[model samples]
Target: MTMAWGRSAAVGVGAGAAGVVAMTLVEKLEQRITGRPDSYVPARTLERLLGLAHARGRRAWLHNLAMHASQGAMLGALRGVMAGAGLRGPWASLMFFAVRLTNDQTFENASGVGAPPWTWPRDELVVDLAHKAVYAFATGVVADALAVRWGPGPGQVHAEEFPGRRRHIGPPPRA
Candidate 1:
């Protein structure tokens, strides 16, 4: 049940891919209801970062998706590491929410394709938050589940080491 960093990272990327799929579905549903146009930040950010000219059609959407999906997968690896450290469940997800938001804003602002989040329209901000939360929670579910194989993380170990802490509920704790 010991944490394996390589395994955790690989599992995390898988979980993140799943999270991206879930987020896409949720976004599609919301778009249907709100008639919101697709956000172009991902594509724009990629284009700028790569020094590519703005794409006008399918290529633009393709760049957007590549950035979006790759970002989700990469971020998932970090979440996996968190799980390996015994950070799971809602609290872990909340921590991950901040990470995800920071990652997005950093890229967007750096690319000069987006304004500071505080300057965004309230509705736009809310929508972004909603999507990011979905990604975070979904990633948490998968990461946590995968981490179950590795047993409790470092945090869990520390907590369990408290005097009089419950033990012998199962096999020896790895964390």
Candidate 2:
């Protein structure tokens, strides 16, 4: 039987949390090397949602932290469900990368805190992609690990017509 969504989501939380942590560490390390200034998208989105103005000091840092972590955890749940359905490996990570990027852009654009991606400077774009890639692949690794307990998910099951995984079409094609 297929895994239930509830269970998938639960495992996803764990996976997502692990992914976020990894992503955070990577970002911190990269920041030291590249001397890149922090992007304010997460903090801006939080402020918009909370109906608060741009903040500074401990308050802004807290908001930024909360937004980053929460977003990662929630997105991880989505990736978890995907893995539960048999979407794993690089293919799944690619899809998840798109999802994560889209999620962030949607929030930023909708909140009017950011402009379209095409409008971003090349350097900013690269930095964003680098960070998101870490999160996407990290989430995929964790989700795949958790879902492995249940075996190849529902989609991996071969259809009836593909029985025994026969490779020769119509009795071997006489080659």
Candidate 3:
């Protein structure tokens, strides 16, 4: 029932990368339909974080790609850990969606590279949420599949023991 941290994180990285690919495709399609310009906030944020000079053209695009890929891989680790802990399926992905949003907003705002989501136009917000949702669900799918080899997680075992009871729930019994 113990969580396999190393393996989980590795799998999560791969899952996250897959998620980024999926999200990118969704964004491209959406952009083509909506005629939305690419947002360079990610690249700007990376430049700020690294104290690098401002980049334009190909450099900015590269920065954007790097940020997206690295961020996805890193965050996917959390999703992987969740799967390893038996928090799989759509519910887990839903939870991860919130986490992903929070992480982005926190860094973007703190870095002064982006504004808060509440300040964004409704359409923009919707697009952002949709894209992130794609990433979360895709990542979750991969993490869940990879973690299945470990069998049910401790949380799953605990749930089976307690069923629908809500009150006076205690720690799961020792293995």
Candidate 4:
């Protein structure tokens, strides 16, 4: 039950993209209801990372879209790897949601394009978390589906072999 790293990553990319699409749709709806302006932190972060000058107007919008899509697709790879390891279901998606938030904070803060989550308004934080959760669970769904071709992951196998064992039972046998 070895993990197929390459295949998993490839599957993840696709899953991530799908997750981004789902998130975007949700964001759009939420924004329409709340009249929340689009956040351009992603575009700013991308510009800083690429040593490009700050953009405005339509250019900024394009940059934002590019960053949003690429980042989601890239993160989806992690979810795919999780699925490849048999970490499927809502629990796994919950974990991935944390990962997604961590990744965003890390990059956004490091680039000095965004403030810490604690500094954000309560409503803003909630909106952000909701969007990321959507991405995580959506990506998880895709990754879990794609990884089915590889059968149960090592973790699943281990769970079956040692349902309630408290002792270290060692790794599951190789397939």
Candidate 5:
């Protein structure tokens, strides 16, 4: 099956809205766990994954959102391929999540935005785990959609990996 931008847009907007909801829920969960409002930034996660230090305004958010949609389509297409190959159930989901997490984390580390291994505290693992869990599901939705669209037949998942790559930004001004 061919990739349709219209369907992709719907999935993207839908997934992004879902992502916002998921982020909100994660914040509430974190609050319940630790008794304070969660202040983790989604943009930071995405930026770190993209190996960027800072994206200061609305333009950055728009760029990130588009990048997300493109990534989502690729994941969905991969899911479709796996399903087409007869994979199913929880394992399929696990594989898709693993692909995204490993790729994202690896990219973050490779691009120099990831936290240094030695700097990671045990407490931080909880937060990271929470982020991974939510993103895993959201990514799965993307993967599933793509799989449905491109998994069964001749085509592969065609979403771009990182859309319109940004050059490094100037360092932020001192507070």
Candidate 6:
């Protein structure tokens, strides 16, 4: 009856949605800035285009959603924790976002534009970074919301173990 892992699954779904939107917005922004239309689609949509759902049906959707959401949540959580820990600021934030932007290679490669050296590198980097940072932030927000119901907590038990068989009870009382 308990849906303990539901939170992570929900996070994946939300993250996938955000990924789709983020990719679209970035492509539009890039096109405007560079005056070139780049054939781009959201990351989540690409997975579907690649026939994820067609091949796996409900299980595929569930798997993709969970995987994407977890990745987004992890990135966001790291950024947040770093910021809160006083180990990061605007400069670090910029770098983090920039690092995430490199993930756009899939979109660019798909366009058949014949990648040119240093072609709009600065613009793409800037745009993708900003877009990804926002995507990461959005993913975190959704995860936090779901965490209220699904986040691991102080004394939560691992899903792999039965309550009574947990090591906390000293090796299940020697069976």
Q: On residues 79-151, what C-alpha lDDT tens digit does candidate 5 reach at each position?
A: 5455444343466667766776575566556656566534778676667666656755664555455546544
Better of 3 and 5 by lDDT: 3
TM-score of each: 0.90, 0.88, 0.97, 0.95, 0.49, 0.39
lDDT digits (tens) for residues 43-127 of candidate 6: 3444544544332555555554554444554455544443332223345455545444544444335543225325658866466
Alpha carbon lDDT of each predicted model? 0.90, 0.86, 0.93, 0.93, 0.54, 0.47
Rank list by TM-score: 3, 4, 1, 2, 5, 6
Cα distance off (Å), candidate 3, residue 33: 0.9
Model 5 segments more than 4 A misplaced: 1-54, 116-119, 137-175
Q: Report the number of backbone clashes for model 5.
A: 7
RMSD of 4: 1.3
lDDT tens readout by residue for model 2, 134-166: 999999999998898888776665333366656
Candidate RMSDs in order: 4.4, 5.7, 1.0, 1.3, 14.8, 11.7
Residues 25-143 of candidate 3 have per-residue lDDT tens digits of: 99999999999999999999999989999999999999999998999999999999999999999999999999999999888998899899999999999999999999999999999
For model 4, the local distance difference test gives 0.93
What are the runs in model 2 whose C-alpha is more than 4 Å off? 159-175
lDDT of 1 by residue, 45-104 (tens): 999999999986899999989999999999999999888888999999999999999999
List ranges where model 6 is wrong by over 4 Å.
Answer: 1-3, 22-36, 41-120, 150-175
- Candidate numbers sorted by lDDT from highest down: 3, 4, 1, 2, 5, 6
Of the two candidates 2 and 3, the one with more favorable lDDT, higher being better, is 3
Better of 3 and 5 by TM-score: 3
Alpha carbon RMSD to native, model 1: 4.4
**Whole-structure CA lDDT of model 1:** 0.90
